[model samples]
Target: MKSNPNFLFPKLASTIEELRQLSISEERKKVLRPLVLYIQRCVQESKTCNLNFICTHNSRRSQFGQIWAKVASEYFGISANCFSGGMEVTAFNERAVESLKRSGFKISSKGKGNPIYAVSFSENSDPIVCFSKLYDDRVNHVENFAAVMTCDHAEENCPFIPGAEVRIPLHYKDPKEFDGTDLEEKKYDERSMQIASEMFHVFSEAEKQG
Candidate 1:
């Protein structure tokens, strides 16, 4: 894997390499094509790439997707902005936070409920600011961005995102089911890796088009 001084941990780089090997099904790949096209058009037009990943809760899959999308975009030398939101606000779940820490992102938090998280992938790079909020929150892009639905419920409910020029249903299985089970930590980590791989696919392909 290529070395990145911006990545805060050596493991982050290697884990991403491992994720690239995971098999993404043809069905999911087809669903992901629109997302790729959106990104390709943005790059070809020299426009800013804004991606908002949404789910029922911003706790798990969406958070992982947002962070990994930014990491992968940077890894591939693509300029992009990534954000995550939910239908309703909820804290970034501790389980998912721990999973990302294990994957080598340096994370810190402030505030109480729905606290803000500063997750850093590399030392010199600015950390990604993360918190749970509505998909239309003022902190995110208000228009001309792609809305990536990371869970089924959000996809079904948010059929239309007013200002989104493009919307993509790139759903994922919720790892929240394993919360209290013996496989809790294992499952959370698995889901994180899954999103990391797919986001890597998204941005890596975008880089090629650029």
Candidate 2:
């Protein structure tokens, strides 16, 4: 695999550079270590690294995880398949979508209740198609995948993920708590950037291990 900085849109690339500069706490790094090791093992075995980011609602943190993991792996020249799902289906939160847009991603959506979003960080690569669905959704890889629990609720609720080769709990605070308040956007963007920073860190370490 070859690094493809050219695959990202110019503005998104700039944003990602900024995210890389953000700090990851030791505690957070410990949580992300398993993920880094998983990617390295995949690299060693010449296997595709498949990740499924799951949450209770599938609307916020999980979505961020899936998108950033995909971007992080691609940016580091790793081959990976990334997906997101939840215990229950719900639309991807609009606030989270706006936060991603502010981070320079190009996103568009279609459908009614739970719209399918086409999210793109790169001009050259195909956009990631995102929607709310069950963890076992047909669109996701059935086996040979890592199950990344991005919320405390989901981690506790999902005792067993049938096809997961490994289960990693990487919980993030919900920005949904600020939904109707004055701090909504700030909180959402904060959470989004936090996720982005950590994900980039994970893949950066994985790349080194490779």
Candidate 3:
């Protein structure tokens, strides 16, 4: 695969290896198939492939999904826009931010409770701007995008996301369950890698087929 400079960062480089090592399960593929097809269709039609990942809190999984998806798309040279939002606004947890740093994203933040983070996966590529906000927040694309539910709570609660051309359920186990425990870091990194793996699979598959 032609590599992107951001993906080549030593910290993120290990993550690329981890993602490559993962074998996408059939169950996971079931969720990803529709997303891949949707992205491919967008490309074929010359439309923007925007993806917005949603969760109840938007502190963790949704944030990871959005960042990794954008990074993977850049790696594979797909022109996809990715974002994350929650049903309720919460600060993007520091723990979650720590996990991303551990995964090799160079991160910086401003503000206190609701800090906006500039997360860089590579030097040559644009950083993924991250924060927690409502799904309908002005920062997110309101139209011609897919609503990807990263948590079951969000998928079940938000049955009617307006302006979403497609809705895809790509749930992940919340690592927040282990927060404040000894395994918190492990669980967070595990969740991050899982999302990174799937995103790599999605973008890689789209590139192959398109």
Q: All models: lDDT?
A: 0.86, 0.93, 0.88
Which 10-residue window in model 1 sums to the lowest lDDT?
1-10
Cα-based lDDT at residue 95, candidate 3: 91
- For model 3, residues 1-210, the per-residue Cα lDDT tens digits are 354644457868876887779888897798799999988887777666999999999999999999988988888877888999999999898998998888888999999989999998777777889999999899999998999999999999888999899899999999989988999999998888889999888888887787
TM-score of 3: 0.95
Report the Cα lDDT for residue 78, model 2. Answer: 91
lDDT of 1 by residue, 1-210 (tens): 232434546888777768889999888788888888898898899887999999987888999989998988788777788988999998999999999999988999999988999999887799999999899999999988899999999999877897888788888899988989999999998999988888888777777776
Clashing pairs for predicted structure model 3, backbone only: 6-122
lDDT of 2 by residue, 1-210 (tens): 555677788888888889889988898799899999999999989989999999998999999999999999889889999999999999999999999999989999999899999999887889999999999999999999999999999998889999999999999999999999999999999999999999989888988887
Which pairs, if any, clash in model 2?
Answer: none
lDDT of 3 at 29: 94
Clashes of 3: 1
Once fitted onto the true fold, the runs of candidate 1 whose alpha carbons sit more than 4 angstroms away are 1-8
lDDT of 2 at 159: 99
